[model samples]
Target: MASFPTETHRFQSFDGVELAWTEMGPGNEGARPVVLIHGYFSTAEVNWIKYGHAAKLATKGLRVIMPDLRGHGQSAKPHDPASYPRDVLMQDGLALIAHLGLADYDLGGYSLGARTIVRMLANGAAPRRVVLAGMGLDGLTHTQGRGRYFHRVLTNLGSFERGTPEWLTEAFLKTTKGDPEALLRILDTFVDTPRDAIAAIAQPTLVVSGVEDFDNGQAHEVADLIPNGTYREIPGNHMSAVTRPELGDAIADFLAA
Candidate 1:
């Protein structure tokens, strides 16, 4: 089973929100740290540990850190939309790096976490390398964001009506604690990016997506947005992409490279 070097610590953001984290691997590794950011609505322990991937990376001699984003895991949940703004999340992450005294590191995130990493790069945080999985270029589409998207996802409160596709319910159930209304508002507020903003990212990015994933296309789109980047596809959809070992191997290999 995959596992990570485990030690828990806390850091306070600029606004006094206490952020919780699990640091993995040997802190003595000469290489830069590898920070793992979990998807929105998911906590680091549930997403990384449950899959056994954390241990795999730890054994590879990479320093790893997984933080519970505000409102998820052990982190404080402000429940205020302003507190979770895209820019604010990026700033909090930078604060975490500074707190650890890491001058540079490899960055990795899944789904919402991945999206946040992208925004962080655009905002000028320089991680030596980046791994963006489960998010792609197509960004969220109106078709997916309307009707079922809003009801089934944004406002979905646990469990997918049984007998309905298990995947549908599971994904929705995973994201329930996140304020749907707040999410929608943020989406509306940050909808468009200036063409210049898209061109701002210069990081060497590894764009990863599952061949059967909903955001595969978007993952490609996100890659195109970066000046120096590459894309690779693995088997499975969003959830399976994270749980499967092959995916972790691919990520570990890419970051090590």
Candidate 2:
């Protein structure tokens, strides 16, 4: 069994939206920070902290910051899709980085968070190193496709406790609290980056994927693209993959390398 610190705090993005984020580990003396971004519909504390990841990484002598993206966790939910654009997400991330005055750090993201990292790197906000789990830039194509697609699929699937696993359903319920129409509009605004985005990321990158869930073969493609990229496969489906401790170990090792 694993547990995490309950301490919580709030920060604001450039747009004035109040964002909720959690920081764990020691006071981060001279250690480079590791920013962890979660997938859509998931919060920082529940996703990353519950698995003892923050504590584990902290013990490894690193600082960790996990933030709840807009419309998730305790952050403000803006009804405007324009506000949630991919660049906006990137800015939100960089804003956190700049606010903390961290000159250099490592970055990691799962699912939607990974996609955001891709956008961040594409926009020239590259970190020293990056670890992307449960996603690849290729999946961003779907994100760029009609945002209405997410609205259609999710709305049509409306609250299916059956067939869907308990944990995933629970995860969905947390971030879908906004007006469905608003979320749809927001998602619609997202346009996935073309292959050029991957080509632009010059940092050392590590791509991780689960046994299940293959989205556009982006993970492998990403590994093949970056000058210094490596690929690793973890056991379990997309939802269960990142929650495992072994996955954290692999990430810690990669960052150390």
The residue-by-residue lDDT of candidate 2 on 1-257, one tens digit each, is 23334467787788888888888766658766899998766778766887776777776777788988777777777777667764677788888887777778999998878887887777667589998888865576557542443555557654555555543554465544534444554564455777766766778888888867574345777778767788888887776786888778878888876
How far in Å is the alpha carbon of 218 misplaced in model 2?
A: 4.1
Q: Model 1, which residues run further than 4 Å from truth? A: 1-4, 29-31, 140-160, 163-167, 170-196
TM-score of each: 0.82, 0.86
Where in model 2 is the C-alpha error above 4 Å? Answer: 1-6, 145-149, 157-161, 164-171, 174-182, 216-218
Q: Give the per-residue lDDT digits (tens) of candidate 1, residues 1-257.
A: 44445888998997788999998786675845888889755778876766766766777778778998766678776656666564566777788888888877888888767766766766667888888888765443222332234455555455556555544545544554554454544343233234456557667888888888874246677677678878888888876787788777877788767
Q: Pick the candidate with the highest lDDT.
A: 2
**After TM-score superposition, what is the CA distance of residue 73 in candidate 2 from its true location, in Å?**
0.7
RMSD of each: 3.6, 3.1
- What does the lDDT read for residue 67 in candidate 2? 86
Candidate 2 residue-wise lDDT at 129: 93
